[model samples]
Target: MPVTLEEAHELIARAHRRAGELGSHVTVAIVDEGGHLQALGRMDGAPPLSAQLATGKAASVALIRRDGAALRDMQQAWPALFGQLDQVAGRPILAGAGSLLIRRADTVLGAIAVSGGQPQHDDECAEAGLRGLE
Candidate 1:
């Protein structure tokens, strides 16, 4: 199923709520399957850089249809190839800790990314967003 605007909003809300619970000010980004930004939410205290980081992470996960950390691992293992992809991808693709593809059954709906806190905290909030969708 394609990700709906409503679902995107739900993802942002859930991620924001989770960030609060974790005592983490964060930026949450939701993107469609094509890696287009659908919705974004930034906590008041979150660092400004988080917005860009979240979007990049979401786009990377959506483009690969895989976990963000997996992409990070791949980048580490193949720096030359990963660097080349940046020119072709147009948008920045950051392999970060808090990106997750949103899938339903066999279809990839989109992706979510959370950033600002420690890597673990960002992942925790992203996980909350995923659980909220279920």
Candidate 2:
């Protein structure tokens, strides 16, 4: 099933809480299966650039149906092709540690990403966001 807006908000809230636990401010973004922004949350102390980065990372995961780390590997292995993907998708695609594909029972619903913390911290917060679905 597709994720509901309420669920998206819950995910953002969980991510924000995780960021607080980590002693970091972050921006969390939720994108639909179509890689369209569904919701976004920027914590009080998050960097301004984190907003765009979180959205791009989430969209990359949603459209690619893969985690951000794997996408980073792809970018490393095929820089040219990966560069072309942004143009092809008409959206900024960034590979990093903060993004995850949202899935349930083998069905992909969307994706979530967190930014402004350390890469590992961001990844952990993204995971927390996914746990919101549970």
Candidate 3:
């Protein structure tokens, strides 16, 4: 099943909770398997660009079917190819620490992303968000 609206909101809430514990502000974005946005949330202290960044991260993960960490590896290994990736996503495909593929069993349901904190903090928040699905 695709990620439901309720699930998206829950994911955002869970991410926010993790961010709070980390003493960080963040923006969370959830996207469907087709790279369509489902829901987004940005904390007051988060960077203004965080909304767009979070969305791009999530959408890119969905489109590429890879977690953000792995994508970052690919980007580092092939900067020339990754440079042309924006045109493919119709937006910047940020391969940052906080984006991850949302899966069910072996099925890819969508993706989730968090931004506005240190890479490790953002990654932790994303992991917390995924727990909402469980």
How much lDDT does candidate 1 score? 0.89
Write out the backbone clash pairs for model 3.
none
lDDT of 1 at 95: 89
Cα displacement (Å) at residue 40, model 1:
0.3
State the lDDT of candidate 3 residue by residue for 24-46, as single tens digits.
Answer: 99999999998899999998799
lDDT of 2 by residue, 10-113 (tens): 99999898889999999999999988999999999999999999999999999988899999999999999999999999987899888999998899999999
Clashes of 2: 0
Which pairs, if any, clash in model 2?
A: none
Superposed by TM-score, candidate 2 places the C-alpha of residue 31 at a distance from the truth, in angstroms, of: 0.6
Local distance difference test values of all predictions, in order = 0.89, 0.92, 0.92
TM-score of 2: 0.96
Name model 3 segments beyond 4 Å from true: none
| Highest TM-score against the true fold, candidate | 2
Candidate 3 at residue 112, lDDT? 95
Displacement of the residue 5 alpha carbon in candidate 1, Å: 1.2
True-structure lDDT of candidate 2: 0.92
Q: Which ranges of candidate 1 are over 4 A from the true structure?
A: none
